[model samples]
Target: MPVARSTKAQSIKQPRAGKAPSVTENVPPEKEEGCQAKRSPSSPQGGPKKRSAFGDITNAHKNQAVTGKKEGVKAPTRKATRPPPALVVAKNNEINLKKSLRKTPPTDVPVEPEKDSVSEEPVQQVPVVEDIDKEQLGDPYASAEYAKEIFDYMREREEKFLLPDYMEKQPDISRDMRAILVDWMVEVQENFELNHETLYLAVKLVDHYLVEVVSMRDKLQLIGSTAVLIASKFEERCPPCVDDFLYICDDAYKREELIAMETSILRTLNFDINIPIPYRFLRRFAKCARASMETLTLARFLCEMTLQEYDYARERPSKLAASSLLLALTMKNLGGWTPTLEYYSGYCAQDLHPLVKRLNFLLTYQPCDKLKAVRTKYSHRVFFEVAKTTPMDMMKLEEKLKS
Candidate 1:
């Protein structure tokens, strides 16, 4: 058998003097030839040596074999790590579930039949009604024919309710008597819980009916009651019954008499009960002024007070309402009547000065003795007691109005 030698043995030089001899005696000729062939041509004089791939492994194994001890290369061991708490719990749950499923026996319980998914009838959807936005109605400044037509219709209708001769026609019914009647009607209106519109309409009906028909002082209550009943029916959502009105009147007029007077009044007016009243115009003007509730209440008090005066019937309802509101704003030390007021009211400060003075005089010098109902009604806290509020100094107000 031939001796085999490693490449390490083939690369060793001969031993020098006094050094142990190199172990090249058992080196194989083939390994020596292989190592010599692998040497670089530029390094034939042997400068720095290059390493072989299996040099250290072969050397370690050869050393172990010569020392008669096995140097077994240990396989690397991995550190035992614990799984996350959630994963551990999940694995336990899976095991428990498997055990439970295996332990439980399946019973022959009857299952419910599935419901039919399709229905025989179709579902109906409701139709929605969209509201018309008032802002998009039309241009306010544009003089469209329809806008003029609307204004003309409103003005013409308003004119129809005007009682040009209301004062002259009622000779027997003095202005004080008329005021007393209206004051009593205000009480009746409140007692009946009627709308303010109903009261204004009732007063209009009384004035209009007096223009054409002769109403004795004795039948005035009957006429007022009938007018209120008709106005209530027209203005209120649920009008008072005949018995309600009769009861408020303390049974002063019988049912048949009430009905007959209502019919006569309706016929005299030709069923034109849709009269424009100061209340509507007052609200519109107050909104334009952005008056507070107290200011508006004061204006409303002034307007309602005007109802007791027969002279105010001659003035246009819209103009009277505007004047009343302007007086109220001035009396409260709020802003004077500005151009915005003029534009909305169609009256300059000079034009409204007279009407404002008239309203102020009426407010300052109210005959509470005769007009107790309206004054007392407004003096309460509910109406903000604006009736009791002092009017602005007349001189200052006059100067302001003049300016």
Candidate 2:
């Protein structure tokens, strides 16, 4: 991919504070397998029954699925009383993870906060953010009406799949071992031409399973492979078969063992595979900011690094994404947080500082040998060679914080 030049954001209208989120969260549309109708045979002999390369392992239960369009969520007009809407959780158990952004006290620039507080914060309103979906009225891929609602539901679901420092529970395996496994999984993703989501979800599966079950060092690869197998089922159009994964392992694990492990992971996690991933959030946040492809790729490179580190295992995916984009903007000489980004992302530039500083540190320095998967991957021309971009100075980060 050609390197994307940095682009200035369009002027943001004054941001009015959002009201309590009242959206009815909708899940993303399910992907349907495209079936090609077979031509009627010349005689009474029937054509072969439809089967998949992977035996439709992704849809073993949905072989006879109907082909019907899902109902789309309807968009609402801007309300006179309400500014832009916040993504409030519809479920009682769901907790808000996106903290309202605290203004980063500026050192050089005097950027104003979105809203001024006169006891209840009554000041000026430029243009309140209309629904983000309004611009793409008829785009099915964008899901314009329910995009925010869908992401809100994802934040709520993040709570259920949160992981503690699972390395403490593994007697035979250490963080280093897990790091190596993730590095290898990155290689697998590259080899298989898998989607980025597949890699992320596979890592999530591994962490979640390790939380519930103890395993030997040798079987760790087995667990990782099975997690990838399961993630592929969810994220890929045509995922690799059992044999493909087994072959990658050099026959270290048996087909039955891989299948058995898949059963265990699903049971342990209660079959809830719709876990929120940072990659999806990064894309959304980058779009909201109107960042350049290079800037977005840089942010992606930062976010991908966290996969190798056990420290960020429990960090909220939304927060990680917001932070990564914030740092990327700053790095590219783009202005700090804008009202539109703050409103849509539910985070201020300051809210991202802790992660921004840490991610900047990782980018500034050379990663250790085992954890170089992300850096090397991004170094290639297709990724805009973002890994080669200069890192922000830690001193500069401190100066920003002190302000």
Candidate 3:
């Protein structure tokens, strides 16, 4: 029994052959005691001991220091280390900046050299023509502002007084009779020394009244005379008296008859007698052409001639004026339908072609017996004798116009 007990104890004391030894089992008692002392809860250091790999490393360092002290081996004191690469570079840059600030900086700005003073000679200026007295300027209608207003007013009122197809509507009054009436009215207007606007308004009133009320051929003269009277009163500063108009009419109508016709004409026209005339347009277009007095008078002659033609009653005042001026320009050997004229008159050569041809025919070919009033009136030297000046041959004019 004692031998069996000894063998069993030997077997128990021996380690298992196949299994690996544990870390705690392989460590020496002294090393384990040191590890336990470093990790103790009641350590000399202030904080509680940490159970980590870093703590193990710190405990190993402490053990090395203690072992060195016990062995009396002197450990070398650590010297101050060089700073990091970035911090070294920053210190060098700061030293460089301080050294640069201590030195004087060179100025990059440039300086200009002074110039020698020189005396200047006085300049001689010519006297301007505009310094002359304004009263010496004779053109009252030359103001651009007033001219613009006149142009705008005429354009606005032109469409209002346009003559419709009076020939188509009136059965009693023939075109010839209408022509005769206008011709006689022109004489009356000339006799009264009335304004050109007055003459045109009077003719317009006659046509406007005729369009609304059909009148006898005999009463047509009275109608025209009454229209002139109404127009003179409306447009003229010193209009002719009713007796003067009656006297001009050869006393064919009494004072009451004249007054009755005037009332009848105004009432028929709805009292709207502010008519636009070709004469104003002629003046404007003549200025655009830079035409002479003779040229303008010729254009006026042609325009006045159109008043007698019943077919021309449908033409616009601006168009008629442009055509007349173009015809006069062509006849006077001046340039025909230039760009300057087109700019102001708003009519190109192509646009003025047909109207110009018609006017040329009226002046050259139309019989002198019927349209005698305009011809005779313009034949005088007072009119620049534009009526006596012959128009260009129609064939040659057509060729030039086509080209």
The candidate maximizing lDDT is 2
Write down the lDDT of every candidate, Cα atoms only: 0.69, 0.72, 0.71
Instruction: Give candidate 3 regions above 4 Å deviation.
Output: 1-143, 368-371
Q: Which model, 1 or 2, shows the larger lDDT?
A: 2
- Answer with 1 or 2, whichever has the higher TM-score: 2
Tens-place lDDT per residue, model 1, 44-150, is 22212222322432344334333321111121232113212223333443464456445544321001001112211111222222222234357666434354354
Instruction: Report how far off residue 299 is in candidate 3 (Å).
Output: 0.6
Residue pairs in clash, model 2 = 101-348, 117-121
TM-score of model 3 (CA atoms): 0.63
Q: What are the TM-scores, per candidate, against the unseen true structure?
A: 0.62, 0.68, 0.63
Cα-based lDDT at residue 244, candidate 1: 86
Q: In order, how many clashes per candidate? A: 0, 2, 0
TM-score (C-alpha) between model 2 and the true structure: 0.68
Residue pairs clashing in model 3 are: none
Candidate 3 residue-pair clash tally: 0
